[model samples]
Target chain A: MIARNNVVEFRTDLPGYPWQIAAGDGETWIILRHKARLPVTQIAQLKNITMKDFNWRIFTKALSKTLFQGTVSLTVQYSEAQHHGEELPRETWVDEHLARESFIKDETVTGKNIVRKDSRVKTAFSSILLDKNMLNTGNESPSEGEGIWHLELPWQAWLYGTGKHQNPQVEKVHIAQVGLNTLLLEILIQLTANNELDLLNTQLLEYGLLPREELIFKIEGQEIEQILGVTVQRVFHQPVYDLESKKLQLRNFKEVDIIFISAEKGGERILTASRLMEEMQVIPFWPRDWKRPVDFGLFNKWLGLVKVAADQILFQGDYLWFVRSIEEMGTEKITALEEKRKNTLVAALPPPRKKPGEKWLKKDKKEQPQSSISKKAITVRF
Target chain B: MVWQFSSAGYMRGQEARRPEVLPQANPEALPEVTVEGLPPQVLSSYELKIKSAERKSPNSWLLNTSQGEYLLRELPDQSNQAKTIELYLQFSEQGIANLFPLEKTKSGKAYEKTEGKLYYLTHYRKGNFFKGDDISHLRLAAKNLAILHRQTGGWRKEQGKKQNLWLTVKQNRLRDLLAYLHYLKQNKVLTDFERLFIENFDFFYDQGQESLEHMVLAGQEEAFIINNLLPENITLLDDKLVFLDITKWNTGPQAMDFSLLLNSYLPLHRWDLDLIKDLITQYHQENPLDQKARHLLLAQLRFPRRYWLYSHQYFSGQLSSDELTPKLKRYILECYWRDICLDQLENWLIGEWDKNDSKE
Candidate 1:
């Protein structure tokens, strides 16, 4: 299994952030642990500082994708510099194990009642990834990049999510170990389909798996033809899978260990060690939108479990992710979030509601809670 | 001849440890194969007359009687691509050239897939492979080829698609070669000889291309074969040279056949232009070769180690290293890229002489 997901930023808290939600069984995730004062934009080296800025994607671009081979999800993160001193908040998964089998039916905490959400990511950026391959000890290496990195398919034993793959079968079975920041080599991949358009760019950029970096093979009963170099240099922009075809017909692969091999002139022998199961937990129900309020049916479920400090907002949901554009917020987001020495933060959140039917408009909550004002909806400006 | 070499055949004992890959229809034993469709009289003695002609390929049996010979090729349980190639050879131009038409079953099927595998029976051609001294048969063989090419020169439409019989120097391969040349130049693997080869290649490839304009043509975008000349397929019978598989674009650049023969013959007899000239004159008299064709042929005199390696692996099964033809070890070294020092066309030809000298 190859891990692919970009994390834009990791900060404490901000107003009106976007998040996303994706659903699948055992997907390779790029889960990021929010660390402030890290030397990404500041010193460009490892150092410790603290900032209580909220890190998340911009509004309007939280996308939820289904798996390719089987039913699953994949999230790709990016960065947008336009957002200034205020960006979105860092993503944290609420332990799904806490979800009681009877929780969803409880009307007060239904899914439709959550406050905010994100649908897809607009900006590409550096991120820490988490996948299902690691143990939950928060021990995993983080990947940094702004480019989309799609995995070579069909995966072996593990299932893969969506990045416009041809096969819409739901999940891809990947047999190999794939952790965050792990690179795999000698993975012979063909288009999951045989379409003229599908094959147009399957062998270039990230899509091209041929002439892999490190491989060992020879014809039977012939002199060992050590194929040391690639006949062609192929890479791909993005791999497209059709939601129509339920098959992952990627070609066979020769396993090559590239741990010690040179990066130049070798068959595909490198493995991108990923961190999914270790540092990240797949939230059972997270918001997948920023512009639109969480559907009335689903929002209630999110508002119930989110914990908060002074300005910190920690809400966990399943298969949901978020992202945003900096244009909405100014550059102060990067400055305020650059270097602060706080592990976490506190923030204001709507007071817990016992249930939707209970009349909360009894002149309360906000400083100017409406006195029985029923205008269908009132915009809550943060 | 059933290749009597160690590396060639699959013996019965090899499968002892593994479970017998029994036919799908009947897992207990070898399924009874009763092919239908032959003349009733031919079927009368089918089981009784059949004899085990190939002992190593145990499943393949031959049924022989006074009427004619029928070879039943059985598909083994394990069907790898190698078996597929063997089957192709069994059904392809090999058995066809020998004047053996497969027996069609009553249902007009070329083969019957018994238990998820295909097999067919055909009459075997009864003729010994022409040895080195069969000179008188060269003309007859050449005439047969000219006739075959003349008769079947045009492509055929099989299953509504055009079928070509010739193979070209695949353009992709040519591109690969050019790229390889660049790589050699870039990696400093190019030697003086290899540099000379580059010049000669540019010269001859152009010549070959020019001569081929009239003689050999490229395949169509839809489908075609060009430059399909190989050694074993070209035979001499009764002083006539015959090209066995002469279909579609495969029939052009007639010098290619002569080139391949020379490729084999040069190493067999080095330092003696007598035999070379004789064969040249013979081939020229039979089928006149143009100057461009001749120059291109000479330029191609240097065989790529890629093809050499294929041949070394092919013949090592039958002939001992000493009994093997000359220039073999050089071919091996060349295949491994160690003989790049002898990249010059002259060095390659000299390898034969060097081997002959060592033999002396």
Candidate 2:
């Protein structure tokens, strides 16, 4: 048995059988020929241990459960014999140079290091042939000289040390008016809840390297597992001021420190920051009290009554009710005023008692007979 | 104070006569008209006897003739009319079946000039307006637009003119926005719409500026584009999508059409990024876009075109405060979702470029 990292090589001494290797979380067994030599009995025992001890289903189920923690598990079934003659020559120049530059200690460096540090390991793995038919174990029709292998492991395990899984710390310091920042935060929270932060984290890692003026996420037709890929360094929430306030305090006013990850790399940060400030400035300073209308029961009742009255006037032509409402409110005061005027008039002029057939008009004319003549004389003088 | 007083007066008037409570007259009623005033020579040229005529708009007439229904339109500008007729003929020659072909007169001319006005006839097309609810319809429209773009790619070259107003348009929008801001500042008392505009002014102004910057960054690749892809301009005729109007076609980046289509359809879908991605993918599948074209598309989408349009209309007196207020409110709501979509699209585009770089 030859063990290196997660891969273990076993020499099958059976005449026609080739050497077998267990790799990738011990879920896959590959048949191949390697330089390592081992006893025939030990190789056979190792093969039995690989095939009999490992439970693929239980291992996969456990890995799937960990997917919510930003780990992706994939089961890849491939074969090596189909690509036996087509394998490209492995290039070891770069790896050898790097290994030579580093200090090699006998105590730390072993056969495992030699295999792991060599580029031939990757080249060998890359030669593992895969086709549509080979992907399905039940329908795999192996051609002549083909060796079938099942490789099941979390695809993201290789990226463990690459810093691709690190999620950006999105801190919302001050958000005004529940606008874009709030919406973005909500989306992030949702993505995290759905266990889709893996894709987001990976995209954000890429985004941090190449930041644009605007970090736009295409949400149209995005699958459930796809990420929004927005890299917000820090969100600085500031107060929304009206245009007048902003203009008045232009000199003294301090802008929000909105640090978009891309802003660090580009010279357009000032423009972006100022734009954010302007966005804040234009947001009308809604008074805290005015966040929601005061829900007054009396006011609501009055509004309802007014609405009903309006409906009646417009649709039913019911003006009588409206007039009656006004009259009812002023009825007592009007009656009292009328009574007082009646008393004053009665007291000023003596009440005249006329016979049933007497003409009140003729009496009035007789009393003011000279009045008409005076009026006519005054008119003539003018 | 003046705005408040006006509002109070409007409220009183509204109370006195509620429009919703009152019975409304049918606005679709077509006025009956006789063909007595129509030019006899023009009718003879078309070789048709008009049975009845009804004015569809100020310059268009729906005529029932011996040969099926036709739209008799009065072309206002002779030069533009000629160019339009030429384009129509070109389109027909290219086998674009979406556009309606003009009926030829007896002399084999597209138009007939009688008195001072030039008139043209086209067979009336019947179809339902594009409501943008179905994905299949959107995909079809996108694919058709791609085909149209491919055919019109060399239109500017053939015409021997470079009508690239991409930057000019952004400059004008920015200018209008500044003017609008000045107008708002000059007002002693601001209405609700004016106040809202002032509140949201900076954000949109920033967007306008960014769009200009993007236009500059997006290299010049001129192609004839349909500038107006409004829902009203598109009609679904059977399984195919037909463009009802093509007069607004101009030479610009192919992305302009994509932007216009998004502007028309995004709001209807509540600015779904998935829908936009699907649309772009469909279009890209038909006519592949380069890096510059994609950048231009992004730049066009980033601009607050609708916001600028509404404010411009209000400031220009095309729309009153009452008409603009509700539109502004609805627009503000749309911006909330639209901003999210824009952010998502930008990130996606950057990712795409990164992938391409890695591949290279």
What tens digits encode model 1's per-residue C-alpha lDDT throughout A266-342? 11111121111211212222233323221111010111111122212122222222112223345886666644434
Q: For every model shown, what is its TM-score relative to the native structure?
A: 0.28, 0.42
Best by TM-score: 2
List, residue by residue over A158-242, the lDDT tens digit for candidate 2: 1111112233121111101111111000001101112122221112211111111121121111111211121111123233234
- Residue B69 CA displacement from its true place in model 2, Å: 4.2
Candidate 2's residue-wise lDDT over B36-103, tens digit each? Answer: 45666666666656678777777777777545567777765567766776675565434454555456
The list of candidate 2 runs beyond 4 A from truth reads A1-382, B1-37, B49-55, B63-69, B157-164, B182-189, B353-360
- Point out the worst 10-residue segment of candidate 1 chain B by lDDT: B2-11
- Model 1 Cα shift for residue B159 (angstroms): 13
lDDT of 2 at B301: 77
lDDT of every model, 2 decimals: 0.29, 0.43
Candidate 1 residue-wise lDDT, B1-360, digit = tens: 211111112222221122233112112322133444222333332323432243224444555433344466555334452243333333333222322334543454445555554555554433444332334343344334333322222323221322132223322223434543454344321122232233234533443344334223322222112223343344443333333332213223344444544443344233134445555555555344445445444434433422322222222232222222122223322222212221333343334434744787
